[model samples]
Target: MDLNLESLGFTKEELQERVIARICTQLLDGVGYDEDDNEFTTASQFHRQMRTSIKEKIEATINAIAEREVLPNVASYIENLTLQETNRWGEKTGEKVTFIEYLTRRAEAYMQEKVNFDGKSKEENGNGYSWSGTQTRITHLVHQHLHYSIENAMKDAMKIANSAIATGIQETVKTKLAEISTTLKVGVTSK
Candidate 1:
């Protein structure tokens, strides 16, 4: 079934997030870690120096996934829209070519096109729009998923850290101390 993102009270962007956390959690699943401590307790730390490299890898992965898996499907969907619109306009079959391959080529041409404004007329001007840099915009759009993924991963890590801290406090620190004021979320529900 064709799902309209806008009609679902959200964009692909809203769903784009949590990808990192979801992937990380899935990847971390079945990982050989300490059995005594929960997943949240024993956390792995990343070095700050590896930030750029890791981000670049994540971006590359995201782009690869988008281009290979997502783009074709999106293109096909757009082709349907294009065909429907063309049929609605009742134009000649060859006039409007938006069938995947042709559409992609046309889009790439537009994307790479550059304009020469220092011209007298359309005949003299070069064929490029000033705002036709699709690389940055497209990359930004696709790369956004990675950015959100990293953020979500960080958030997930933070939650895990907090959980570990609370559990540690309750079990280890709280036990040693006769009285404790820490509000552990352990089995505690808001009233």
Candidate 2:
């Protein structure tokens, strides 16, 4: 079912579209995908690719919903989501914060603002961390990308990118389709 933002106090449609487009685009860019690839050249061919993406996103979203919305015991490490938590020693105050909470705040910050397309932050973009026209969140994205290498003792980042993009597409499509379904069912009743 389509989630109703109106019920949640969001009244703008274009903003919603922009949010969707932005997130989807970010997810697409995160995993090293190119929307202009010639492999999906024709309209129908492109649509088929989109369908595949939608299916993958659906499965991811369903899995997420089931795990998050139903079962609370499972860990909240979303495959498509990039979470970054950190702990640092203070110079003098000696205060500390947990890494998990820090990462959650980062994710929250991302959701509250528009991510630049350069893939790097305003601080790191100019330092060559990423190229132009790439989405922001490069740090977390790259961290996740590199995790597989560290976890499995590999040296490649492409595999992680591919998996992230695949999962992101799957989750995004599923969430959007569910929202649409809810909207379509507003007045319908089973007889």
TM-score of candidate 2 versus the correct structure, residues matched by position: 0.17
Q: How do all models score by TM-score?
A: 0.29, 0.17
Q: To one decimal, what is the Cα RMSD in angstroms of model 1 from the true structure?
A: 36.4
**What overall lDDT goes with each candidate model?**
0.58, 0.61
**TM-score computed on alpha carbons, candidate 1:** 0.29
User: Can you tell me which runs of candidate 2 are displaced by over 4 Å?
Assistant: 1-90, 110-114, 127-191
**Per-residue lDDT for 128 in model 2?**
42
Per-residue alpha-carbon lDDT of candidate 1 for residues 24-124, written as tens digits (9 for 90 to 100): 55344423334663454222343333455677899999999999998879856876654323455776545445567576776775534432322122223
**In candidate 1, how many Å is residue 6 off?**
71
Q: Ten residues in a row with the worst lDDT in model 2?
A: 37-46
